[model samples]
Target: MLEAIYSHLARRAAMYLWMLVVFVAFGRYFTLTINVSDSLPGTVFLVQKGAKPGKGDLAAFRYNGGGPYERGSLFLKRVAGMSGATVTSHDVGYGYRDYFVDGEFVGRAKPLSKAGKPLKPGPVGLIPEGHYYMAAPNPDSLDSRYALVGWVRDSQIVGRGIRIF
Candidate 1:
């Protein structure tokens, strides 16, 4: 009788182990996905193929490369510009706000909007290659808006991520 009881317990333990393995494998393969940050807290969309966000395209980065938030800090920002894209600003010019993209006037017109929203000024030069310009929607978020993390590289991208539960 003791041997019989031991055999039954062993069988039940094996079954439980098998169930655990199946649960873990199923979750990993079927239910696992990536998620993005909730900074804008407004419209959210997926990155479809051919929907490339060029200069001025708001994007999110995988890791911070010694930026304002230190290393490993994630970023969500707009594509202020891109490689070879022109940029201009008045922050260091000691004058009114002025900027242009492809020689066209961008949003840089007024220094401060009526609602106290500062104008989206431009940088004081052309964007370099192998890197993309970026900025944050909210000032509170750590992004290229800060003086630290400037342009991020394409190689730094983990993947065109999406919010998946």
Candidate 2:
């Protein structure tokens, strides 16, 4: 009976140790994010911190904007254009521009922001190394198609986002 009790206690101690390591030692490796925008498809995501994002992957980045978008806000967006990929934009009339990556249509950008601010088109040309073009299905999204959210650098990539909803 004593041996059984000791074994149970050991198991409990081991479990607690593992929990402590996971929750405290490596807590920064994982994060939960809630998406409040139509920029992406899901409402919730589990971000794998330090994970390298690839083409077509959902990446989380710290947002740098103003006028409703808080600076340093975490944003989840799609990696539409990868490094070395060609990104081009052409006038689509009515002060709008369409963006393409590697000859594939990515999305379009409007001339004005939701707050009635004039918006400039995103950069056009080859995507530089350590940079990516982010996009969203919703055209109103302030992604890489506009100067406000221009090429997202690798340094800004927070993690790979796995959508939960």
Candidate 3:
């Protein structure tokens, strides 16, 4: 009886070991990489080597709040302008749909403040090196297009949007 029990236990141990090996191999082949948690509720973006974002690349980044990031507050925006791209805002007087980038006009950006005013003095200036400017599809979204968030460095970017589905 003792010999039988030992054999059974050994078989179970070997089975577990085999399962572990299979899991490791599967993980190596199908790597599941996720960067943001509840703090950043956005899609998982894949990092592309030597890839430069143009006007419409979705950028995922961590929101650097004064303290720890609060759930549902942080966001990931799409790349509107790349490094060295100039930005400007125009005051339309009535509603204020004014914004420009890289000496070329883009669009208007509504302020997050109560004033509902766009960034003052028109031209917001050029996007710095190793940094990418971003904006959200949601008009109410607080993004780098505003002065508060500003330009984000490349390192801050967790990844780029690959597939939405």
Candidate 4:
């Protein structure tokens, strides 16, 4: 009976070790992220490490913000403008300005945040190389339209995300 128990325990240990090895090998190639915030349409996404970036593609990057979202936290957003694209900001009226990439409307920068804190619009002119403009359909999303999320650096990007739900 003792020998049988030992065999069972060894099998379980080997199974766990095999699973860990598999995860370590292909973990970076694929991952799953859950979005608690309703910033985008999906709550679950499958991240592809080597996926290409394009306009309207979902990109995952590290957050570099203050308060609530800590630095290095992963945040998923939409790719609005790519590198070398001409970005412009126009003060439409009130405390809002419309942002565009290559003259195509991307999103609007709100004058204030959900907390009512005054917010400033993002950058204009050409986007630098290895940088991208990200946004979210939710108006209250803290996207690239504000200084907090200014521009998403290429180094900060983790991968391209595909909505699973």
**What's the lDDT for all of these models?**
0.52, 0.88, 0.58, 0.88
Model 3, range 7-115, lDDT digits (tens) per residue? Answer: 9988799888899999887555332335343323354545443344556875556555532345333345678788878877666775455666665555456533444
User: Which ranges in model 4 have alpha carbons more than 4 Å from their true place?
Assistant: 1-5, 11-17, 50-52
For candidate 4, write residues 80-120 as lDDT tens digits.
99989998998988989998889898888889877878887
Tell me each candidate's TM-score. Answer: 0.49, 0.85, 0.57, 0.87
lDDT per residue as tens, model 1, 20-111:
99988755533322235444444443432223456655455655544223566545556667788766654435334544545655433334
Residue 152 error for model 3, in Å? 1.0
TM-score of 1: 0.49
At residue 101, give the lDDT of candidate 3: 64
Best by TM-score: 4
The lDDT, on a scale of 0 to 1, for candidate 2 is 0.88
Candidate 2 is scored at a TM of: 0.85
Record all residue pairs in model 4 with backbone atoms less than 3 Å apart, i.e. clashing: none
Clashing pairs in 2: none
- Candidate 3 local distance difference test against the native: 0.58
